[model samples]
Target: MTTFYTVIDWLMVFGYWLLIAGVTLRILMKRRAVPSSMAWLLVIYILPLVGIVAYLSFGELHLGRRRAERAKAMWPSTASRLNKLKESRRIFATEYSPVARPLFQLCDRRQGIDGVKGNQLQLFTTTDETLKALIRDIGLARHNIDMVFYIWQPGGLIDQVAESLMAAARRGVHCRLMLDSAGSLQFFRSSYPSMMRRAGIKVVEALKVNLLRVFLRRMDLRQHRKVVLVDNYIAYTGSMNMVDPRYFKQDAGVGQWIDLMARMEGPVATTIGIVYACDWEIETGKRIFPPPPDVNIMPCEQESGHTIQVIASGPGFPEELIHQALLTAVYSAREQLIMSTPYFVPSDDLLHAICTAALRGVKVSIIVPRGNDSTMVRWASRAFFSELLEAGVNIYQFTGGLLHTKSVLVDGQLSLIGTVNLDMRSLWLNFEITLVIDDDGFGSDLACVQEDYIARSTLLNAKEWQKRPFWHRLLERLFYFFSPFL
Candidate 1:
């Protein structure tokens, strides 16, 4: 019996070493960012089996072989469809300002979708206003309505949007709704999905979670994009989910969640529609050739409209395109930079870019919610504040509510607004979409919104912030150390 126990112990020791060796080899071969690679190695060596299990479940950057292949297969048709829009909506290299050209080229050269001119944009700052706008648009839809959201809490104004969608479906307008499986698990369990389906609305869940398929893909890589398209002419995108702040997360004591949405009209709406179609096809295995821009339906004044580029970022797309683009914007900012987001855990490169921008005399300001839903994210975000304050970057904590708007404005002329948050998950893991607008008119409007947030926020003092309890500082450092995984 003693000899048999000794053999079992030796075998277990051998198995542990084997895991260490194999995981180390695989990490090196993967060629991830140096910081991420080093962090994973530390976790593996220190935490033992738990770290290996975490890495195996989440370290990989795959979307499952089948989903990846489906996305690859659809690329040709998607590219072809984009090309068909060139003669009508595409802008030449010389049409936009020089400041916008580099960022535009980064996405255009990689994704083959250039900036489309003559896009009319309306920024909605309140939840009730945005929902009303969506319902009004859905009411007018004659052909089709495609909507996607990360969270779909069914209550208050959200149910009104649903009733509007159902009415549209009954009126013979084809409507398809896509919800993230994990984010909207509550809604899925409710009767809303079945209710919509019975009303002739096609409902699909994106990135469905299955425990048996855990080895095939990362279960937490969610579809975090919020998009709504009506008749391929009017589209909406932003950080706002399909939820009423009055009814969502009220118990968290963060106050009402404030959000912003951009309602768009013109040719660029078709571009946003393409994003929805790609996501829909990847999940449903159905090819959809979205109709081209209907000039008669949503006419544009080419000389005065906004130049907008839609960046749909995810696993199959170019890695860190939005992150790099944002960094470039920060580096190019000669006058000022303003940013707002609920989550603000930036990557090393992004953090450096922001601090450098401030060090170089550009007025850099970041607005974030004082009360965050995720303790880890809040701590990880504050971990970088000391460095930022030292470099003259101003941090403002909004006291009104949870500021959920995700936007970046540079030089009062260029603005980026959409689902991309300033965090590792948004920068690397989740599927996100962003709109790069190069119009002084739209940028001015967005700047006003940021200014309002600043007015309502209390500026963080460097000395006061540094006077926090030692344990608070320690906790922040600990979370920052593992922010890559967060």
Candidate 2:
């Protein structure tokens, strides 16, 4: 009995030393933000074994060598082949408006394009309409159809898309489907990929997570982009996944999700296609050249002049430029800034920019779901609401449904739309695409959508929030401590 007691005591002492050595190595070898490093250390101090295991599994980003190599390989081709676009001098003739210039210039410097001119965007507010438009475009494919969806669950409107892809493939219009391995796991295990394969549609699953893969890559890192291009003329983006939102989070009790998608034409369509091509190349190591010169490029209308630029960010990029871009947009806003997203765990930089925007009288309003799919994320976001509300940013809780639209409107003139949620997963862990548009006409159209959402949302009362139960505040802050990882 005495020997057993001594052995256990020694084991505890050994584990304590081990924890210290591991943390020392992590601090010296791993390059992480100070807050993140401190957060991990705190976890280690509180729950030694659990924290070490968690840090080992989730700490270092290892999305595999192919992920790093794919970005390196694709950029040169992107630079040389697609960079030669002869953007018309009409838009550039007049300097970007003061409100938009900083944001546009930031984007232009980070991504290699000023907004592609002569573009048109058709916005869809519901899942049924978005899928209808997507199926319609897939049906019209002549040259090829390219699709990359993070979540491709098999049901609802997914069959329509599947049928369209199979039909397009059968008719010799090439079809390529790429779905994230984790997000689309059940789809891969189901008959969807097999059916598409049998029908001649090339299918690739991005970043499969497995026991062996845990060491080879960051298991949670995802490709959360949703893209579809038909021939070389039309493209679609924004928050709508292929599945119907009515069933998207049905189990979460959030009724039909309110989402938005933008169907694009003209040069922007080709730009979207090129962006898709980069992802396809990354996943399959096959290059998709800018189409044969014989294929016609859709030109925007002569009278209407709108422009869009595609910004894709993920583990592949050298830096998280998407985070900086959002910050720039917020900081550049002068009049009104209305933003909507499902999840809202923002980084320090984003949080500061938003608070500063509101404090400086930008009339900042952020609309989010009253209830969300993830309880953890909801709690973390709740902690920030108090700070933001105190800083003058109006927090609107949507009573209508889960607001899944991720868009930023600056001075009621520029609109940004895509898969990026205002959260850490979007900023660091997932591959995301955001479309930046500089046009008042389109902004007004998008504003009507935002206005409709605002009508359905309730402005949060700051004093009421402050009066919430002590337990509620404690739970929210506890979850918020994990925001960097969330």
Candidate 3:
């Protein structure tokens, strides 16, 4: 009996190794030199079981047949609208800069969202302003309102917004709300969803977590997008969470949570509406009908000289458009590159791009929080800072508050702003959206914001970084090893 058991165990080990080898070979064939594919191959070779689990959780890109069927059933109108946008872009010969044009072409061809026109943008810097604007927009909803947030807490400022949404729903305004299952788990267990539902609001948890659904996809691929569309003519996107001052605790040592959110009006709003509709369709099998073509939507007027393109990325998509766009933009930067993000676990290609850009005489500056909520992520981020500093990149830590914004200003002529973070999850795993604004005015405005953050921040010299406690540095090194999936 003992001999038989030993033989069975050996067979199982051999089978596992064979499976890992086959999967690694398949991944290499599918993705040419993508960081994600390479990382998966390494993981499978170094740690077979963990690699297999990670691959199951995040390695697969296809959303499977059930999701595809549900998407088609729920959002037939949205699909039609996307087709129209594609047709429109093909007719126009809109030109983008070399760095951004490739990404635009890729998204337009593959994702069915075209570069829209006639849109006006208003940037909000503070949470107070953002919430006020959000409430005002909610109050102005005439037809329908669609909102998706990663975090939605009740009481205080968020409660006010929740009440406003409920009030609008009571007035017969069509309202649909989607929140991430992981990020908004607290709100899900709370009375917010039920209360909104009682007020005639439709609330759906995006990417419901279930062990049985493991084959469908890992629960870690969260919908980190924050989008609000009203009446198909106005939309808002940024990094602001739906919590109030109490949650961030500004009065405490946590500092203020600064963010950037832009309100857009024009044909671009329709594109944003399509994104929300897609998420809604994916979550619920019900699709919201888009507005008729005759709806007097104007072209996006240029508020500034900068041209802007919106990039959306996720596991459902074939390519990581935003990540590719950032890498391309960073490589294209001739003078300077300034970036601000809450989490900063960049992929190998992005790291090399920044370092190589700096080596070529381009000024590189990264603004991060002094302390982040995620200990592992912070440690992993620190492990890379020394190398960046050594490569002539300047690092700043915002001391006033948690810098929750994800933005990049390149050469003062281009700006990339939106909900995506500079982390592996945002790059390859999570659903993210970013707007590549080509307006000099918008870029200048974002640069001013970054400057202000730097003014309130403390610069970490290479000497100071090296003086940190030995154990702390060791922990950071240890965390760096697991950063590929973080």
Best by TM-score: 1
TM-score of each: 0.97, 0.93, 0.87
Per-residue CA lDDT of model 1 for 379-424, tens digit only, reads: 9899999999999999999989999999999998888999999998
**Model 3 stretches astray by more than 4 angstroms:** 1-55, 58-65, 68-79, 86-114, 248-253, 292-307, 467-472
**Higher-lDDT candidate of 1 and 2:** 1
Show pairs that collide, candidate 1. none
Name model 1 segments beyond 4 Å from true.
Answer: 1-5, 89-93, 295-300
Tens-digit per-residue lDDT, 1-486, candidate 3: 999999999999999878987887778777544655766777888888888877876676545566667755654565677677665552232766655565567666766654654467889998888989989989989889988888876657888899999999999999988998888878999978888999999998987777777767666778899898888778899988787755755554666678889888766676667667677777676666666433344433342223456777775444767777888789878899999998999988899999999999999999999978777898999989988998999999998778899999888877888999999889887778888776667778889989999998999889888898999889998888778768
The Cα local distance difference test for each model comes to 0.89, 0.82, 0.79
Better model by TM-score, 2 or 3? Answer: 2
lDDT of 3 at 164: 93
Clashes of each: 0, 2, 10
The RMSD of every model to the true structure, in order and in angstroms, is: 1.5, 2.9, 3.5
